[model samples]
Target: MSLCFFDYGYSLLLRHTTEEAIATCIEAIEPARAALTSQLRNTVINDLIEGLTKHDWFTELDIADEPPPVRFSLREWINQAKEVQATVFIAEKQEALVKESWEVLKQNIPENSLRFFTLVLEIAPAVKNMFSFLKDSDEIPQNNPKLKAHAVKVFKMTCESAIQLRQKGEVVVSDTTLKYLGSVHVEKGVIDPHFQVVKEALMRTVKEAVGDQKWSDEMGSAWGEAYDQLAAAIKTEMKQQLEAAPKSSSD
Candidate 1:
């Protein structure tokens, strides 16, 4: 089941219940005359009437006049994709953290290996925002073919990213393990040091190769710039709100 279906079904159910409850309340108003204040009764009736009359009030609800269903569905798809991607990312990071600990604990570990491991850890927190847009979707993509395509793209990117990360992880582990092995001149530490590098590299490598299609350096830079703009706007708005706050009695 997709997250979209779940959200839409839940919303529809809420709307239906609200309508039923309003009807029941209105019908019971005569019997329980004092249950609702006069203003409350008027407000409830007006809202119910407006909801009931909305369709009739609109003479033409053509496709152009209505919200684009495609855009709505696409947004839903993106949300679901982001949620699942985020889960994958956090899980990967957890595994990497364990690997990092192992590498740090192991004897004769080189600083070069530490550098790669640290680089891998640095990106985990950065990718946390990627999942903000994704939500659990239960809606099947039948209503929108574009959403289906987007789902396919997201899945493909995930798989590709996983494979590439695995390959790179192997390379990093092999290189680091050989260094550690040469330094210790022992065989027992091979598993600890090598596997740690492999695991951590695997987690960090995918920030570029996986998740969203446009998460490359260029796109990432643009996103950072946009985030700065958004933060500045929010700060300004907050400052304005503070300035407009009611003056204290001391004033």
Candidate 2:
């Protein structure tokens, strides 16, 4: 009878332990699962809008066929830019959503900070695209000087981050440079002389773009290597920026 009673007691203890473990798991997962759902919506905005902006359907603003340069309608172009800008604004509004989601995630899975940060990193490229969209907006040039300045600020920030990340081994330098080059192809098509000019100009500006920083000898050599490829790829973008920079209609 004592042996049977002891066996029953052990079973009860095991059952209690199992129940507690299950409860702990459910508590941990509930908030994280909810946060993941919210993050899904954020991703929809950042990724979807970015893909729309970066699409290669970027035809030259010149649409007429008669002679020298075709005259695309400024009104129509500006209207399109307004629509895109609205989308970006909508995405920006979701900043609160991202914060809430991250809070839940952090509370539930504190150990996953780096993973969450990396997930946030996924939106970095999309953020860059949003800035590029703003930069390419004819609306800013025609109607809003303030917005044009904001767009340039965003572009500068992205360029700075890309350069720093490349140097620190925090991100892929070549890929970031390529993305910048691709953005430059908006007004300037992938044609010959223009493309070559832009690429060269981008290379020349890298050091200035990144700002002056102290690096060890090893880092300096690594930076030199990274700079070589980026210098070649960024020429097209640099030339395009120079052409666009001074021609704001807000002048």
Candidate 3:
């Protein structure tokens, strides 16, 4: 970007942040967090922060009593992005740790799938009503082929979406996958609480798959955060579908 644009943007940010100026400047760029590629967004924000010290007006925004040093959080723009859950910036190390554990998780997918569904049922037996495969049989859901297949498919989709999240800067799955998720949840009458139950079960299942020796609080957090992002994407689609459906007669 041109230096002129950078200076202008930085001035706008200063005004909005310190001066509490009108939100027009900040509002205009909010969409950039979701629309712009991560690399571009990072480049723009980083350039703005890095050039702060070079500006003659740097002292104006600086709050430190001492000179020659400046301290701030991960940059205000980044904080803003995180607040909006848009283009979230994941550290390289955290991203790598998740990627590594994900590979190990794959080895346990079959066994883990059984355990995941078992936990889901155990956590909320009411959830069983939503599973069509369980309607015709007395067999344990974990043992049923249909349950196993569906469980594994869902586990893969949810976890895989989480895995790629670091690169995508958001939870994004194939449009086909999104459509399937949106439709099934609508058909099953799934709600936010159901998603929470499944999320807890998924967390417990992942912990078991990784085993005690390998599992850590950080891993739990990473998986939980990723799952929330994925769930939010699905819910957004579901909301749209529900809104678009023909309204019932209440007139």
TM-score of each: 0.18, 0.20, 0.66
- Once fitted onto the true fold, the runs of candidate 1 whose alpha carbons sit more than 4 angstroms away are 1-214
Highest-scoring model, lDDT: 3
* C-alpha lDDT values of all predictions: 0.38, 0.43, 0.75
Q: In candidate 2, what are the lDDT values of residues 148-241, reduced to their tens digit?
A: 4543443343334334443223433456655566565544443454423323333333323233462233333343444344444455455656
Best by TM-score: 3
TM-score of 3: 0.66
Evaluated against the true structure, the overall lDDT of model 3 is 0.75
Residues 94-135, candidate 3: write the lDDT tens digits: 466677778988997888877888888888887787888886
Better of 2 and 3 by lDDT: 3
Candidate 3 worst ten-residue window by lDDT:
84-93
